[model samples]
Target: MPDLVIALDVGGSSVKSGVVQADHTVYQRRTTPIDSSGPAESILATLAAIIDGHARTLGKDAVLRGVGLGFPGPFDYAQGVCYIHGVAKYEALYGLHMDAELRARLAWGPKPPIRFRNDAEAAIIGEFCYGAGRSFVRGIGVTLGTGFGSTFVVEGKPQRAGPGVPPNGWLYAESWQGQQADDVFSARGLQARLAAAFGRPLDIPTAAQRARVGDQQLQEVFRRFGADLGAFLYPYARAFDAHVVLILGGIAHAMDLFETAVAQALRLPVRGGALGPDAALLGAAELFFA
Candidate 1:
């Protein structure tokens, strides 16, 4: 019988999961909506259902290896406890022992081990092992979405501290143009720029659509964003002696608009994620495999 593991990438809006074989083949990928603002019990039930569903699909003959999750922070990944407060998501789970709570709700005869890692860190590791960062010995993985997420990797291992790495290996809290890096380099930041340009509120998706049709003003917004992001990453890249920069997340889909600016500013190889949304899922599986 083949051993199977469940890998999950838990976000504020949804949970992405997959079943993995021992050889790292991922299948049965699913995205389920979740209300992170709901009660802790509800959240746990949702997660349990996902796990149970996957377990059943594998049938009685399959060996349940373990479960792994890539979750957001500020969390105790080592302890499987939630400390994410004042973040407007998962507040109900604060201080709760997630691993225990989840185990209690599961129906497995012998509950498999559950492990966790920071989502951003997991995504980077996924890319390092199988995607863009595989070609580089040292690299930075940046996810540009609702917020800015980052991780530094050296020789396929995540580095939280060292020369050129910021506190916690996070770039979101860093100052950029008198504001936090997240305030200037995220989806909201792009929307804000678009709004300022047109003197009206604009969403990122709409702006991206316009830019694709040769809207010069909208195109300029993305270009500026790229330049700013490049400037923001420059010092750290130099300090860490990184060989490449891998961009992931929803915003990365607009790379064509800003790729040149980022390359020109950073003077390093900049590439978009090759694995798309699967990077984090595979990264989560690494907890069991690695």
Candidate 2:
């Protein structure tokens, strides 16, 4: 093990990079919104710059032990390739060799070993190692951000299930069962919910504030969000039998707004994710060392 590690969590909205110590402490963290033309080439340039920037900060003798990158799209981690889901704009990376690319990009200055996983997987790692995941083995991690990204954790182990869709067989579920994961259980979905209900623009903070003050429309909107969350989570409980779904990210933290309906849906088989704020940052370093 080296003295220093750099973990890069690449998200749809932002890219966060930070340095971690052997004792699992995080310092000198930096984040920038993901700004690119949504093409593989452009995104690659952006990512490469972030990586280099972090490496430059760790100093010459710190001994870079490893680098871990979490991408937003479905990925084949075994292949070290990321499949851009039209949103990332990198059709060429579908099976592109990442080890080689990373080596080529940061071949200079005592390169530490590198590892890659889905951004969801990385967040789960964050939860399991040091955040909400510290409690149970059978917890599912869900980041309710721009998109809903989830990982199934069994006894502190996150599924390496890449970007490939699972055999959960959701077609009939969607038609008859009601809510789906990405549509109803995401931040973007929350925004859409407020928009659809009010027939006007509804920012995240504004809606939360009005609802706090007993705004009927906003309260209804939040209640509806809770209901949809319960509906979406029902299937996860049935399919994976997850003990707790460790909630992280911007939307998940605002659990107060949707606690009524969301918690109401928690029955015998399912429960809420207890990982509080800073799960992602904690996981960023913990995943690397673990």
Query: Which candidate tops TM-score?
Result: 1
lDDT of 2: 0.65
Task: List TM-score per model, in order.
Answer: 0.96, 0.81
Worst 10 contiguous positions by lDDT, candidate 2: 167-176
Over 76-114, each residue of candidate 2 has an lDDT whose tens digit, in order, gives 665677666555345556666766677667735666677
Model 2 CA deviation exceeding 4 Å by range? 38-42, 59-61, 88-95, 160-179, 238-241, 268-278, 281-288
Candidate 1 lDDT, 1-290, residue by residue in tens: 77788999999899999998877788999999999999998999999999988887887788877899999888898999989899788999999998999889998657989999989888888999888888899999999988899999998888889999998789999999899999998888888899999789988778888999999999998999999999999999999999999999888878989999998889999998878677898788888777
Backbone clash pairs for candidate 1 read none
How does candidate 1 fare on TM-score? 0.96
Compared with the true structure, model 2 gives a TM-score of 0.81
Q: Each prediction's Cα lDDT score?
A: 0.89, 0.65
